[model samples]
Target: MVYPREELYPREVFDPRDVVDPREELDPRGMVDPPKVVDPCNAVDPRGAFDPRSVVDQPKVVDWYNAVDPREGVGSRDVVDPREVFDPRDVVDPREELDPHGKMKVVIGRLQVVFSRAMLFTLGLVFAHSLVDAAVLSILITHLTAEWNEYSLWKAAIVVNVQEGTLAVAHIVFILLSDVWTGPYKMLLCSAAISALGLSLFQVENVVSFYGPLVLVTLSQAGIVVTLRPFFDDQVMSAAGQSTAETQHWTSIVWWKCITLLAAASAAFGLSRINPFGTRSLVSAIIMGSALFWFLLGTKFYSFDEATGSPLRDAAHVMYIAAVTKRNVEYPRTPNQLFQNSSGHVKIPPHVSWLRCLDKAAVVMPQDQEKPGHICTVEQVLGAKSLLKMLPIWMTFLTFSTVSATGSTFFLEEAASIDEDFNFLTFIFWQRLSSFVVTFACGWALEELGRKMKVEQRMILVRMGMGMGCCVACCVAAWINARHWRLVDSMTVSRLVPQYVLLGVMEGLSIEGLDNFFITQVPELTVRYGPAFEECVLGIGKFLTAICIYILTLLWRWFGEDVYSSRLDKYYLMLVVLSSLNLIIYCLVACWYGDWRFPIPAEDDDIETANHNPVDEAVQEILLQHEKDSLPLLEQKAGQDTQTLRSRSFTRPSSPMVAHRRFYSMRS
Candidate 1:
């Protein structure tokens, strides 16, 4: 429970000029009078201090002491004096010994703490952006199909699918830029500005202008979403200083996201109902502009990761090197024979056999020695292999994403047609709320279970599997609801609740699982691309949904201009079958994944070790000193009360200080 002082307050918070040292603040003689100073050489040997003869006739320190002492009673060993345990060399002053490099490391660590705390501002930005984003997207389809536009349902669906697809592609482009060139903060500012501009353009009446603005909005939103989470994560990890458990840090991220989702849902419910859709767009623009302003206010405190050169480029180099060397070079017989740097700056994992051919990329050829760029490091090759290993698991989630696309499109259409008085916004509100609750609960439960069971690595797969199973259930519920709506004339929007709730639950589970897996499993240098890859996968799923709808319409009358004539129940039935198959495939992939653990980079371990609290070392020194000072007093009294000590019971002290203090008081 006693945390180090550095953990509570970073070193940057204290300045020598601002702090008044007690030694300099007051006269030493006035504070502790000269008369009160004890001279050890001239002092009396107060009874039972060190002289064994003084306590020859006194009772021993405690009765029954011999019962626990190994030398006195139970299996006898050499009688080792407690005083011998205190070694002067063992009690080091951590501050006094630290070199210039160590001092700089301490300063950097404190600065990292200051930067990490700035994630509070990042969370506020997430809430603001997500609020406006959800409000705009929730009403977009309805706005297109309004009386003024008179747009066909198919036309609206195409616009929505196109926006979704654009978002997917934008995620990749923006994330690459953030990682390789611009950095996240600059990317965030640019995206926010573009989003505001796009939202403002929605006021234009020309139909031809719609698609252009929609693409702008989708691209900007993708950049914001892809950049912000990773930015927040960087701060959290730095703030943790590699000292806290990884599960706890991720749990905090999940909980913060749930809060952002809840806020966005509330904003959507309230702001999407602003009568005219143009007014809603204008309101979203104002909110986004305000968020951008608020984000800039924290610019000084925010931590920005320096843009590393592209992982894709490194991957390409690895492949090119492997191909060029294929005919002439042979794979190294041992991993150490490969081209690792003498300095060991990069921590490469043991060579994996999955992509054995790529090992040639790392072979130290005669020419490669002179041109280091011609050969790839083993780390780069393994990073590419890790991505390939994750491919099958990523493919399994496409069906889940396809099923999710229905909530905003077909599900809303179904609700709108059921009853003229039904509040579809309220349905969306409840659905968002359900997902937020499930996400919060699942994150907490999984963290606790993983900590207790020591199975933190496997929990990500379990969460993904649960979400996939829920996707199938969601589709089944949709089919049932659609069938009941067709058979009965009095059905209300309430009939769609089950499917909506299941959709929310599925999202809460699967999305977090995918995010955690990607972030943790990928090489540290390329982690920014993880979430972007997830968004790209979901976008592909939306395209697949569009493709399925197109094929179905071509073969039979599955969809029409409105919800009433469309055989949506059949479409839902098809999703149920596809999702069921996806779930089975996911299980096989999970089994194949087995016990492979992501290797934490060696630098992180060094940081964790170096970040230990110096205050803890100082405290330990004081405790050891106390033990040393008290031992002779106890030894002097031990022989006098040997009979009395045998009859009295003594419980072990909770701490070394307690034991030392108890005997010191006895000597007094």
Candidate 2:
């Protein structure tokens, strides 16, 4: 029978029942064949002829399955068995399909989640705090010597050194308080308020007022710096979920910090041009107050953990117990024999062969088992070891830190002595701007390198070493510049650019590398204290610098009352020698240090397995059930085909399309 045109070739709106099967009208072998079924939805022409060109020249389909609904357009001729179409083995993972770039998309999505309202406000606070810090550092010595005209250059330098020392001490104290008594949120609020008050006090001129406000501002700034990163990290991890990796989280922190520093540098440049140092201080206070208000607005979104016991105290306790415990006590034969709580309250690191002496603390004596407080856990012993191991590496960076402290004190003084009319770039502005630029460049380069290399921990140590090397180079350049200035009658500030640039590069690499090392290498219990310990070391470095200066001034007239006649070239050479020695020591320490970039498998595996989503498990179970249900139907169809084959002569089709048509014909 001749079918109507509408029945032969279905239009876009035609019902499935309206389309006639070609096999019914013509022999299956003689069916009209298109060149290829490129566009399955539009294989036929309006006149019921197979359209090869239309099929071949079709637009690319993004969502092929949804382009034409199977339930609506599929006729008897197009229908295929569900078993053949829905193979579980062929199913693509939704994550792979959705994320074309794999981990890149995931990292980007995590960053998007982490940069919430609370994080943005936190960054705002960082920017404001950094701006205030840069302003204070830039103007403190200048204000003392030039603006106030009361203190000599050496005295002003001493004041700056004292401020650095105070900052270092404050970092440790504030971080301890945050970890043991006050939470980070309260500490941040209090510190910001105190900093604002101190900035306001810059309006006063007396020595008592100057020293008092200097101490207050240094203490408050230290608290803010030591507390902010850890707090920000907590907020990020909470927002991004627990699955986020340490590298991505820390990388994001560095990127945000770079941006904050860049903006702060721009502000410092503006503050440098301001007539009076007090006006700059007042502007900083206003910015800080506004940031404080902004942070308060996002209080609801911040993640706040309760104050816990101090890790430092726990480490000390572990050492005391280990030392007080009988020296004759035998070390545990195996790690399992060590004192671990039955309830699994603490996570113990895998036993290492080194530091076997400390394992005595974890040994359970026959009588001490009943008294719980007498013996320390394996976790605590390992924590003490971790802290002790970091000390050598920490000490190596002291000279680097001392070199950094000079940027605000002697570097500023040197730049001020140069003819400003010859060079517009001031010390504070150039140093900050160069640092921001170098930080951005180095971060980008390192990120790209990290993708190709697996040596993350090694690279951190190398980067730090490179930074120290740069500090040595910076000091050498400073010495040369100083010598040139003394030799020339008219030397411009432009000559100091190389030293400032090198110093910036050094700060970018060493500071960031050191921060990462502290954050990642420290035991989990003491992770919050890492930044504070770094600051403490930095403070000690400042003290060492001060001592060096005092001794040099007393023994030889290296620093005079002002910048003009001082033997700064000699001082820079001394710093160069010290930094070179420290760089060598750092290399030795790096050689002794073990790689900690990859996590301990024993501790992480359970955490990774336990972190699986329940919804994903449920979906997998449902798919398994579907496959089980589908098996019987497939078997039944195979049985029916076998019976049909036995009853009649059977011939296999030459091609897949012919077989598909024949199967449909037999079913019909």
Candidate 3:
């Protein structure tokens, strides 16, 4: 079955050395060295031949050029030659930790290293997943009513809405429970299992079919958001190095890009007519199944542990709670229980090198550490005394809950008109292309803008932009009603594009940045909250929208259509005006926004100066014990050489671990 090796690459027929040489006299340092070409079997590849099993297919990538030493050269190694030294990474080693589970994992294939495939898959799954529902509403509902005589919007919404609500509550409960007692792996595994179960449930048929899987669908999404945030962030952080303060920043950018790409792909696939099976069943099955595969299975290799696995990292976080607060570790537990306390003063082991331990003690929280919180001093609250620690928590709730929430409203609002004249696929194009174009443009704008400003400034701008954008959207609606007041049919592509485009622009400006802000400001444990935060906002926004919609409904009934339509412009304008007002308030609030203790580096030089690991309170507690009680014990526990403190006890706490003595970071 294998094709002849000759067909793949004809080594005997081609010699790259003739075209390019590593030992070119013009070359200074040999980075441009041509790959060393050996005979068909690689008798002597100056770069050393990688084994066949190393690559996926063992691609017979023959070295196109052989390393040649010139008689007149200033010494072979002394002179840089491409043949002498081409980075052999192109020839991958399968044994070189190709598996995601490997302790030292390379960025899965090269492109994944560059773009993050795991996250790409996750984001794409969700983005594409929406298409199924959109179609369900667009086609299935229409078909059901016309053919089966069984379609009810209120019923359908109730089913989905209730299921979603139940799912959200269960998800929060699960997250809280897991945060305290479970390892990140356990939660991810459980989530994956639950997601699979939920998807399978969608296959069931009933009079309440769509409504039936509501709880399952909701739970599945919660699991995905909770698990995915850390899974993606960890990969990005490990590969990125010390300046990973904004690992989520990179994650958000990739996430948005993938959303755009998926939207584009869905547009391309648009309403398939391949077999015309039960459209509703097929759509539900696909969505649930994909969610299972992506949020649960495909990411088996990608989880939170790798990102936030170190004991040192966890201990530091727990210590942050202790160091800042005067309270003992006996505090009540929350959903996230990385926080712990110690009342007794246990002796510090003498052999421990406080400074050396302090060095590595600086590692960021592993991805598995979800919803990390900082123990802020009373002053850290920035005068929002009542809202200090609470702001981040409530804000996160508002953001994450909104993911699928606003989504429903937005898609519903856009029920796409289709003419029976054209083929089904053409209609798909309109919906998809437009959606993707909007998503992509927004991502691009945010990334481009992110690079220009300080992260703190960026944070403030995003919130203001988002609140204002919402207002703008409302206004746009108002304008649409105003300009075309008399003619309902007068609204054409031209008018629609302006409104749609503006909404899209606002989406780009606000959403990604808002997501990024949440991720950046919190500790590593709380990084998982990024998506949760965004989704919450969406949830809240949807609820708010729902309430508004209800109020609108009441107004419509009381005032009648003529009166309501007449006031539509006023309502829209009111939204715009309110948004402008909100923007002002948001900017003012953001002025007080500060960086997480560690934020992403702003420049190249920061790469080094930024923390490899810093000895913050978390580092101190995990590294050593209280000075008063532990000193005698620690002094006794000193090394055989009586020199460094690193040779001592690494055990459960029995003492107050002071900051400086805890981490030998000074020496580190």
Look at candidate 2 and give me any clashing residue pairs.
none
- The C-alpha TM-scores of every prediction are 0.69, 0.70, 0.52
Top candidate (TM-score): 2
lDDT of each: 0.64, 0.64, 0.39
- The per-prediction CA RMSD against the true structure, in angstroms, equals 23.9, 20.0, 21.2
Query: Which regions of candidate 2 are displaced past 4 Å?
Result: 1-114, 241-243, 246-251, 325-337, 341-356, 420-426, 443-453, 594-668
> Which stretches in model 3 have alpha-carbon errors above 4 Å?
1-112, 115-171, 177-210, 233-256, 272-278, 283-407, 410-467, 470-474, 482-486, 489-499, 555-574, 592-668
lDDT of 2 by residue, 1-668 (tens): 55696675657667787656866466343444454334456455545566535543343444353345457685444555466689987887764333322222234542432344566667777777778766665457767877667777777887788777777767778877887788889889999999999888888867666777777887788778767766776655544454435433544545455655665566655765665767778888888899999999888778778775455765776777777764567754433345542222123443334555776776655555334445555556666776676788888878887788788788778767765332223555566666666655775466557546856667777778888889999989988888888888877667778877888889777776776565455454455565567778888888888888888888997888888868988888888899899888889888877565213333431222224344433433333332332111112254342210000111222211111110110000
What is the alpha-carbon lDDT of model 2 when measured against the actual structure?
0.64
User: Model 2: how far is 276 from its true place, Å?
Assistant: 1.3
Worst 10 residues of 2 by lDDT: 659-668
Model 1 deviation from the true structure expressed as Cα RMSD, one decimal place: 23.9
Task: Give me the displacement of residue 296 in model 2, in angstroms.
Answer: 1.7
